[model samples]
Target chain A: MTSQHPTPGDARPGGRTARNTAAVLQATLDELGERGYGAITVDSVAARSGVHKATVYRRWGGVDGLVRAALEHSTERHWEPELTGSLYTDLLRLVETVTSGFTEAPEREVSAAAVAAAFESEEVAEALHRFMSDRHRRAAVIVTEAIARGEAPRGTDAEEVIRSAIAPVYYRLLISREPVTADDLRRAASITAAAAAAGTFTGTPGPPTP
Target chain B: MTSQHPTPGDARPGGRTARNTAAVLQATLDELGERGYGAITVDSVAARSGVHKATVYRRWGGVDGLVRAALEHSTERHWEPELTGSLYTDLLRLVETVTSGFTEAPEREVSAAAVAAAFESEEVAEALHRFMSDRHRRAAVIVTEAIARGEAPRGTDAEEVIRSAIAPVYYRLLISREPVTADDLRRAASITAAAAAAGTFTGTPGPPTP
Candidate 1:
């Protein structure tokens, strides 16, 4: 969706700048969803955003800069799944949110375009890596809480557990081109939970002798 | 590397046709490895293969056709990992071969380009899906062997098990932009083995009561 841009001479400088940035970034995502990375240009983003081309160039420098900024902005606004106390529920919630993007056509198109961009552009790759790292760090809290509650062994690698939990969904999405059904999400959660409980994800040796 | 082309008028018609196909496909991969999917054209493939542009156009129709043919040819020649009887070992071998493509620069470039192309082109996506399906089916034989040997549940979904085992490696390579290390492979094998033993991958309920 295209965002509303502020008038050029808005009385509030901070609000105006924020709205401008938001409009440009939203336009970037829309363009990415429609045209993909290979075909998108700064002029298209500027035309779509209703922002002056000079302003767009002055602010973002180029398409690469705009793409990185747009991704970062999206990740910043992304909602983290609430931790529901149970690790399995928490993981399932997270997985559902991740896979839900694929179930919706617009969101899936944007995600697919972003993924293709990551492979082609180092700027997008680094930005995406940062975005995913932040997401994993947030999701890892479930594992940490589980460890504290003795649901998982101490020294369990939280990020690794989260990664293992979601890997299958992404594999199906990007590699196999399979529709990631809810059943797949449930299975991924179950598999990761079973493995974590079995201490398969602990980075070190078994717990010290009791 | 570009493959040697067949002479214009070889006595054996079948042999000459096969060699021409091989050369064109190799040239496609070489071009993909160097220029990526977004930039590649049929003229480049023809030039690289030492084949006339008209022949390339007539035979392959367009870039999409050439890409599909090249990927299918590559998949046909691809070596399936030898089944090692033990499910864990078989999965590990398969994962290693898949991740090994990322270890070398040329192969990694080609793979990264192919992944990008899959996102951009339906033809490439279908080709990649078919290629991966063949691999998963071959790897599923390990799971079947495991079932017959009483290592896994009788109703274990072999393809799902195989997908679960290798998903983490693909996740790290594509989404996380992280290296799929030997330790990662070992851990994937261990985690999948534990989950399978726990019946997490069995699509149906546990074995029938004795």
Candidate 2:
């Protein structure tokens, strides 16, 4: 969805160019979440970030390019599984990190734009689709590792498992007009853990118990 | 959010009032989804519906009111639970209905408007919230019934249970940009069902040699 490294060929004569790019993209997100797709403009982003208009345009080309960069770059890296010796512990940690984010103020405008983009633009939608599918695959690998360790069943759908773990928090945040409480997080984690555990608890516990 | 009955006392003095209202509203939705909110106009709906502008105004008051009324007086209805004496079956049915809806034509616009309306207008937001909450509660009732039937824990947080049952499809629809296929629906139902069943499936087996 974005360049892992900064875009090539846009370095300024001074060393401040990279810093300027990151800052401008950041303001783009801030404004995006505040104003939505229709309201966002390259000029506003440049003004907000205190970058020159030529810098924004010469480097990013236009609003779509800048928006994609901002949205894709705004995504924080997910935590790696800490392998707390139990699948339940690992996933609970994941759940905790996620629940903490619900209160951090919704990036509603950026979110709104991305969603609108998904409906209105196939290019943006494809990038978003790829990003999400990669995430699903990553979670599946972790859950599959748990299954191998005799923590869950091979039949458990890791995608479904991960989704159930996080669904309530989002529903509350986006639709239900409720807060994502710690209690809710703990409850969801508990249920997911219990189900994952039961998968092995009812079946063979390990590799032949040698 | 929608009304079961058409707006009472708002009908025009026309011979075929019901037919006229449906045609007009359908035309309005078509224009809105295709041409967008700003481009849509009362004149267009009247023209498209083959009715006069006076007729549309007499019923809906104007364009904004007409848009609101269309969403409010929608022909679509929420999912109904099919209690096959199996909580899994009931939940699976619900997920399948919701998942399948995304593939149909109206899902994108419906979802966008519901979400956008929450931010666009307070009145629309209130109606959208009621519509969402009612659908959620319907699922919660099913979870509660499952508990009573010993398919889930006696006092499961029915709302949480409901969210878990439906969350995966939503993520798939909103974020993942994938069609929530039947496989996706089944997997969600299976994971939640397993958890719900585990909470109820204690080893006691009803009564201990009573």
Candidate 3:
């Protein structure tokens, strides 16, 4: 049964509400991984989560809402690279994080399901965009640091650099259906680094506008 | 009824079989563009194409087979860039072709559906892989030409260069849910060209090789 207010036990740090939400979100991801977005439903999620159907409905609204929540949760836990002062190392670390999703089974399943869901649902699309934007903004800090150190041009597009560095790996993963190896990751970073150093990403004018 | 033997007119280019096959494939793409892969069915395709359900079933084997045929047909018409002798011009031509799909409504719809289908179905996945590989191989010729002309390094990974040039645009198109612009196309080409000319994609050892 759905309660109008949170239970008294919901007040604590690992409370009933928190535990239930965790179980529900985890169940949502598991269902997505197993069956993809089209096959998932709130009823199935509730059954798998062991939470009451009414609570699942009342709390998450529906399947789309649950998927958005689960994606947000998953991306919150996703890795961000540690800045190593060198653009190449920072980029390599970032590429490692991104390529790991394609290489590892669990991550790959989740990513594949998310990507599928984005094409199927507007809510998932918005959530995915937000998630990627957040990740890109965080990773772009490396490029910003490089700019400060003169490792990259003053006007280099940080987000573009980060996106370009990882785009080839993802292109292989999602589009071309090719295996993304460590070598591929290294090449992606190296190519992006080379371009960035060459001012390829800089939005500066050509020939001083003469 | 399923016919064990081909009709006399089946062998002719403009005959019944050829016409039916063309109609069916066209209907399949229309269905994919309008409703996407999840909503496609053999019966619907048969009805839409004005072909008998039995004929559709017998000829293509099933929905997957029909989808594969449709995908093959679609890719057959997909544009390949003209060789411009200069790598920059050639890559720009190639990027224009790829980005055109995103900018054009009909092609964008079909592409979005195909991308969505690749995530959802194995048949579409195989077809998409083959299609992209064929296109990539064709586009890589430009990079090979560049290598031969001494415009790029000898070991520059031609396929990688092509993929890298277009990856950002595709990444924004599909993943980021962003609108790709002509500026993005030019930037992709320029950055990839810069990297390729710098020998970043050469599969060579850097200073730390020792």
Candidate 4:
């Protein structure tokens, strides 16, 4: 991979080039924490990474490009899939992982800053969307597996359930300025899981009137 | 209330003044139809309502003031009480009311825009949060009522359930660019409802291990 940017040269398949791309992404995250998306420019990143400016621009083009590459490494390295076989257990695990990584503590400082940046800029928003969607795809795989096992119930509406598990933490972070905790993730996980298992996507399913 | 930027001789006792304030709020909603919040200024609102700039300023210091004033009369004229005593029914009604009001044919444009503006602008976001927290108090009343009725299972985390109900719709509106449909609202209501009703909130209520 081109040290400044991943290109055909890096794509030709050698561990050395792949390692360079990894370093660029690593530096990107480092810079993200030191200087958030709003302040971090391509020039600064290259200087920090000891890479040429051409490498940074040629591969990622701009902030969005660099950040997307950053997410490619950060989200994967930081987040791991958990398969507990039970949909509720699995979802709860997923919720805990997400909160622990992206929402709750030190990670939230970096991740939330990025999400807040998305609100301020359209390009950043798109990059954030792409990154989140990719992560969503991973969660989707787990949900689909649960559905196959009948753990998620019939017509569980996996997408809605997945989104439901997430919304509150982010809501609290950006809107309410409340702290998102392990307890919060647990609560979200519990509600979404129980609903998904019971097939709550059907209707209100309130106690029937006599 | 004080008039724009604080003016002399604007103070009054009650009755007619309260009525005038209400009139101003209605006018604000009407003006919002012609322009979204970004397009709205304290000046435009004063111009539309035919109130003095000082009067508008005296009442609301900034955009937050205008938005708070506007929200007073613009939402559901009245909410149905948490009767029927079923939390699911109560919550379904609440979600449907909010989503329907925004999706309503005539008011949809400005209603949606106003909500969007609440998030997009810093001044408006705080106002909107305070606004939602007030509304959330109303929903909380329903959950408290559920606990009183003992219809909610033991150890139920009602607050989490309620928040989850609204989360997806907000996500759909703000991020996904989707209409908050009756169906979507219902699914959200149902998911939160079914799981909550099951007493899953207390602990490890995952899929069946068998």
For residue B30, model 1's alpha carbon misses the true position, in angstroms, by 1.0
Candidate 3 TM-score, true structure as reference: 0.90
iRMSD per prediction, in order = 5.5, 9.5, 4.3, 5.3
TM-score of 4: 0.64
In terms of lDDT, the poorest run of 10 residues in model 2 chain A is A201-210
2 or 3, which is superior by lDDT? 3
CAPRI docking class of candidate 3: acceptable
Ordered list by DockQ, greatest first: 3, 1, 2, 4
Candidate 4, residues A1-210, lDDT tens digits: the string is 445555544554445456657777777777776667667788888888777789788878987788777765665655446888777677778777766766455575567556645544567667666667667766776778878987666666666667777777756655444567766766677666666665664444443222
Give the count of colliding residue pairs in each prediction: 0, 1, 0, 14
C-alpha local distance difference test of each model: 0.81, 0.65, 0.82, 0.65
Evaluated at residue B89, the lDDT of candidate 2 is 79
DockQ, per model, reads 0.43, 0.28, 0.45, 0.21
Clashing residue pairs for model 2: A33-A109
Model 4 lDDT vs. the true structure? Answer: 0.65
**Per-residue lDDT over B1-210 for candidate 3, one digit per residue giving the tens place of the 0 to 100 score:** 235445745756676788899999999988988888888999899999999999898889987788889889867875666898877778877878888876687777788788888987788899999988888887888999989998788988898888988888889878877777667777777777766776777765232110
Per residue, candidate 4 scores C-alpha lDDT tens digits across B1-210 of: 544333334345445455557666766777666666546777777777767778778777866667766765554356544455677778787777666656676776666555545544556666556656666655777777877787666666655656667767666654543456666766776666665655655565444323
- Mind giving the per-residue lDDT tens digits that candidate 2 earns over B1-210? 235444544455442577688888888777766666555689999999998898788878886777777676652455566776777778888877776655567755665545544544556556566666777777677787877887777756666666777877777776666776666666567766776665522222111110
Ranking 2 against 3 by DockQ, winner: 3
What is the DockQ (computed on Cα atoms) for candidate 1?
0.43
